[model samples]
Target: MDHVILFEGIPMSKSMRGMCKEEDYAFLGEKGKHHKETDTLGEDWKEEKMERERRRRERAQQEQERIRELEESRKEKEQQWRHHVSELASTQEQRLRDRLARIHHFRDFQRKVLVEEMSLQTDSESSQALDQLLTRI
Candidate 1:
């Protein structure tokens, strides 16, 4: 008598070549041990594949998040650097203006002193030198 094999509630036999491959026949062994072991191995392989895919997706997401954070930090630093440079330039300009104002005041004071001294002295040589120096300044 010929034994009938069942796969997914359907009868399978060696003559049914279209229904299963030759390797499917290897699942038949003493006490159905071969089929059970094959089923267990298949389930384990699928589970392992799914786990690996999950871990890969998680790692990719983490990398993207890290890159986004780095970009934000870079922009923030750039903005801060620009602000610092602007402040430094403003302060330097103010100091330059102050120095120019003081120089102008000193020049005016020297001119007043020269005028008063020339009125009291008839020394023409020193008067000419002082006038030349004031003109140079």
Candidate 2:
């Protein structure tokens, strides 16, 4: 008979029956506007989600870089400490060697003095013995 059928919110039956009025076109345009609004809302939600993910990734990357810098700094400090310790050890070793050499030199000087004193005592004894023997003759 003359029934009106809606196709995507637009009347398609009666062959240009209800669609001939400007009011009908305006009403159908409102339906399309609602669809566009829904599509834009979904797009905005997706964009916001993507932006949040990007910011999170950037923060994670910055944290990783900071950790790497800290590790490198620790390694550098450790290396410097080792170098400083080695230098101190070397200095101490040299000081110990010098002290030992001084002790040895003092001991040698004392031995030489003792040898000279013994020789002087023996020479005096020999001279007194000859004098006694000459007086008796």
Candidate 3:
């Protein structure tokens, strides 16, 4: 009697040629064990590949989130710095305006007192000096 092999639900015989490659045959002590092991190994390999891919995608997402947080932080710092600089500039401007106003008031008060204390004809040069100083200021 001739022995026949069933491979994946298909009958195969020794006389068959070009139907399957020689590498597809396994000659171990246990029949069909090599094919079953090959099938299980393929399943395991697919599972491992999918798991690694999942991990890689998760890492990429986490990195993107971290980058977004850093960008927001950097923008916040820049905004704070701009606000601080503007406040300082406003304070300095107000102080300068106050100083200018005080100087103008003092000059006017001095002019009035000097005019009342001296004769205009003899104190013309003094009056001119006061005018020049006020203009220069």
Candidate 4:
């Protein structure tokens, strides 16, 4: 007696060239038994997959746009801060130069006063010497 296998109501003999059609065969086990097909996903599985992929892409795009905006804002803020710091440095340098100029002016005034005092003392000593010489004569 010849043994026969039936899959999806189709009879398959041992010596048959093509035992089962590709679409009708679900999964072939080690024992050569074909597993029955089941509904792993509902009828709306394709639509659900499409919707999920669309939402994911949208979220990724939004995140990228937000990062770009943040970078631009950060660059602008950094430029403004640099400008502010430069202005402060320039103002401080100008103030320092003005202070140094004032110190120089005060030093020049003190030197002029010392020279005048020395000249007056020398003139008075010479006049006293001339008077003593005249009295001796």
**All candidates' lDDT scores?**
0.78, 0.71, 0.75, 0.65
Candidate 1, residue 33: Cα displacement in angstroms equals 2.2
- Whichever of 1 and 2 has more TM-score, that candidate is 1
Write the residue-wise lDDT of candidate 1 on 44-83 in tens digits: 9999999999999999999999999999999999999999
lDDT of 1: 0.78
Preferred candidate (lDDT higher): 1 or 3: 1
Instruction: Give the range where candidate 3 is weakest over 10 consecutive residues by summed lDDT.
Output: 1-10
Q: Over the stretch 60-84, how does candidate 2's per-residue lDDT look in tens digits?
A: 9999999999999999999999999
Off by over 4 Å in 3: 1-31, 112-126, 132-137
Off by over 4 Å in 2: 1-33, 117-137
What tens-digit string does per-residue lDDT give for candidate 3 at 55-106? Answer: 9999999999999999999999999999999999999999999999998899
What would the per-residue lDDT of candidate 4 be over residues 1-137, giving only the tens digit for each residue? 01123343455575562755543443332223321223335436777888999999999999999999999999999999999999999999999999999988965665456546545354666546544543464
Candidate 4 is scored at a TM of: 0.53
Better-scoring candidate (lDDT), 2 or 3: 3
RMSD of 1: 6.3
Per-candidate TM-score against the hidden true structure: 0.65, 0.59, 0.62, 0.53
Most lDDT-accurate candidate: 1
Preferred candidate (lDDT higher): 1 or 4:
1
Q: Which candidate is the best by TM-score?
A: 1
